[model samples]
Target: MRTGQQPSGHGFGSPGAAPRATNQNTVLGRAMGKVLAYIALTKPRVIELLLVATIPAMLMADRGNVDLWLVLSTLFGGWMGAASANSLNCVVDADIDKVMKRTAKRPLAREAVPTRNALVFGLALGLASFAWLWWRANLLAGVLVVITIAFYVLIYTMVLKRRTWQNVVWGGAAGCMPVLVGWAAVTGSLSWEPFVLFLIIFFWTPPHTWALAMRYKEDYKAAGVPMLPVIATEEHVTKQILFYSWAMVVTSLILVPAAGLVYAIVALLAGAWFLLLAHQLYRGVRGGAEVKPLKLFLQSNNYLSVLFVGLAIDSVLGLQTISEMFS
Candidate 1:
């Protein structure tokens, strides 16, 4: 059986050690792992919320006769654009991410993805988004998506996030772009309707993000990020949350004249509940009760989802025609 030397009985080779098996299951598992890693780099959960804001804005803009192709194109472009921005942010924040528990497992932080690879991926996605929107939607929408990516990457992530407590407040301007892009894609022009939507999202950002910051205050502090909850007292943070919650509710009502009676009723009821939750958060923090900031955070997410759902339903029902009463 042996030509040059006798084979070792230990393994399928005549070596000192057994050769590892490259079975189909192992090979497939590795491939799937890499695929999931890339997906995680996109932050799909965050993108879900952004798309939620986008489609509803488009529905409101078209009053429901939306061109399916346009919606699909905008969504694809938005996903690519947001992925590019978020991936780059992970690269830039990788250092701090290593120190923070919540983000410690991100691709860049875990070294699952190389920084060079992430950078290239981000740039490619950005370019692809621009081309997709420009070709499928329109020039204005494409340009707006580019601006949104730049604003989040340049203005917020690079400039504001680490420097001031006002980061989320002022930087929220980028998040408001979806409404603008949606409106422009449909009408090719700006108007009071979309701008009011922009303000509602702008005002909502602080409270929504601040509630999350409260839960991660220690992580932000240790990471040297000056999130409001990290730099301010709990009472101060909750009071600010309350203020912004009320402002968001008030700003949402401004859309009443553009959306209609159904929107008005939904906004009123949802706003009342939202404000109540914010008040409870404030009171709990003031009294040092056992309530978690996450309670407010969860309710805030629901509030937005409900409000947007109302918009979609109202658009289908043609209730926007009622808005002309005030207009």
Candidate 2:
């Protein structure tokens, strides 16, 4: 009859109350941790870049009147698709990832999540993304999202990444899809504007990645991944990085004519600075200096962040000269 006493053989006020609460808390904590891990697996920084590329294409297509709903839908779809692709990459690269310092701690690589569970999660996300895009955005955007996922997961991860130094070159295709998705989400059709933006990102991937690869050449070699630095000499890779960085600057400038005068001026300044950083890397690589590649790698990260910010600024500002030039 006592409030804290158990009835018959039971020891507490409610049968298994304390144990159940403990279990519930444990489960809740685990669920929260898993959710955080899943979010991390989506690579928020990479998604930021993808979104940056997307918004400009949306603005250019709508000519300053981007559809808010469509943009939101496309963003959702893009994030899901990217998360799925990244998850698949983790699953597929588990073995190699374990060997590389850069990826050793990934959920799949470290067995923090079961491979089958990760695969299921990835597939479900991919399907949800497709459905979201088709229903809320447009079929074209949906299809492009699927293609991007397939390209990154199958073409790049399963095949090209292990076989050739040109992995990033071909792999870059997937990275460029958000622009197309953004364009289609706005206009329900593809156009030159998206294509130009796509090309800029496509060319930009190698140098941006190669600089990091140079810093991790030994790890890549140990893992037998055959990244550009692993496949080619330091001098060769550095020169290639410089070449691509220059090309990226030029390609970004193409938007000036298509995007506007504001875009052009921003592109010119950003591109020139990016190229200068690349040139410095080139000189260091030529001189057999290790610090140069790391410096360039960091600079490349800034280059992308700034370039996309500029695109978004131009989009919101609605500079007439740039719009007229593109128009």
- Which number leads on lDDT? 1
Model 1 per-residue lDDT at 39:
79
Candidate 2 at residue 57, lDDT?
A: 79
Candidate 1 lDDT over 121-226, as tens digits, reads: 9989999998988888788988998999999999999999999999999998888888888878877777888888888889989999999999999999999999
Best by TM-score: 1
Question: What Cα-based lDDT does every candidate model obtain?
Answer: 0.86, 0.82
lDDT of 2 by residue, 1-327 (tens): 889965674566656577888899999999998887777666676777677788777877776565777777788888999998888887888899899998887787777788898889889999998999999887988999999999999999999999999999998899989999988988889878788889888888998889889889999999999898987888898788878887888888777765656677778888899888877777876777665577777777787777777777677677675546555
Per-candidate TM equals: 0.91, 0.89
Error of 2 at 282 (Å): 0.9
All-Cα superposition RMSD per candidate: 3.9, 3.8
